[model samples]
Target: MLNLAKIGHFFLHLWRGVRELSGDDAYVQYLKHHAAFHANAVDVAPALSRKAFFKLWQDSQWKDVRRCC
Candidate 1:
């Protein structure tokens, strides 16, 4: 039983590492930042929806020049 629990915890850590490497965890980070920085402001808008956050992220990724001249 202890070994089984260890394996499950290992997989959970591995999955989070993969998400961090692949940028799948960006929204989670964004939400954390928003909660810490903006959640208390009454005039601040709410955090973006998942779909909207991804849309905005994708747009920002391509709206700049990435290569050196």
Candidate 2:
């Protein structure tokens, strides 16, 4: 029998796994990295919009793929 703490930990891990698999955290991480990368540059352009980001991501993902299983 699982205790409440065990069950809660399992659900937390499951939620995090789903977020990772779904790329839900990608944009947030991108913003963080982008901010760090350009912290002192000051001349860089703005970040990509969600639509543009997804388009670019999809394009890159498909560019080198030979077949889909």
Candidate 3:
């Protein structure tokens, strides 16, 4: 049982590390920020959907990078 527990903990950290390195946390962070913004704003805007967030993120990531090799 102890070994099993340790294995589970290891996998959990591995999953988190992979998500962080792969940008999977971007949408989650965005939602957190959006909630905080809305909490402090008098007229809050609706949060973007996941698909919209991913599209915007991808666009912003490559908008200024040159593809020429």
Candidate 4:
């Protein structure tokens, strides 16, 4: 039973690492942050939908127009 639990944990950690490295986990973090800090705030707008959030994230990531020579 201990070995089985270890295997399950290993897979879970592997999956989380892959999601993090691939940028697939950003939305989940964003949601958690929003829920923790802004879900009840009076002035903040509601959280962005997943599609909008990704669009905004992508835009911000590439918006600086940096060039590497």
| After superposition, candidate 2 runs with Cα above 4 Å error | 1-6, 66-69
lDDT of 2 by residue, 1-69 (tens): 759999999999999999978888777777888888998996799998878887777678677855979
The C-alpha stretches of model 4 lying farther than 4 A from their native spots are 63-69
Clashing pairs counted in every model: 0, 0, 0, 0
TM-score per prediction, in order, is 0.67, 0.69, 0.70, 0.77
Per-residue lDDT of model 3, residues 24-48, tens digit only: 9989989998998788787777899
Question: Worst lDDT window (10 residues) for model 2?
Answer: 57-66
lDDT of 1 by residue, 1-69 (tens): 479988999999999999988779989988999999986688988899999999998788887786777
Under the 3 Å rule for N, CA and C atoms, how many clashes does model 1 have?
0
Please identify model 3 stretches exceeding 4 Å from their true place.
1-3, 64-69
Error of 1 at 21 (Å): 1.9
What RMSD does model 3 have?
3.0
Identify the runs in model 1 with alpha carbons over 4 angstroms from their true place: 63-69
Which of 1 and 3 is ahead in TM-score? 3
Clash-forming residue pairs, model 3: none
Of 2 and 4, the candidate ahead on lDDT is: 4
Ten-residue region with minimum lDDT total, candidate 3: 60-69
- How many angstroms is residue 54 displaced in model 1 relative to the true structure, after the best TM-score fit? 0.7
Candidate models: Cα lDDT each: 0.90, 0.83, 0.89, 0.91
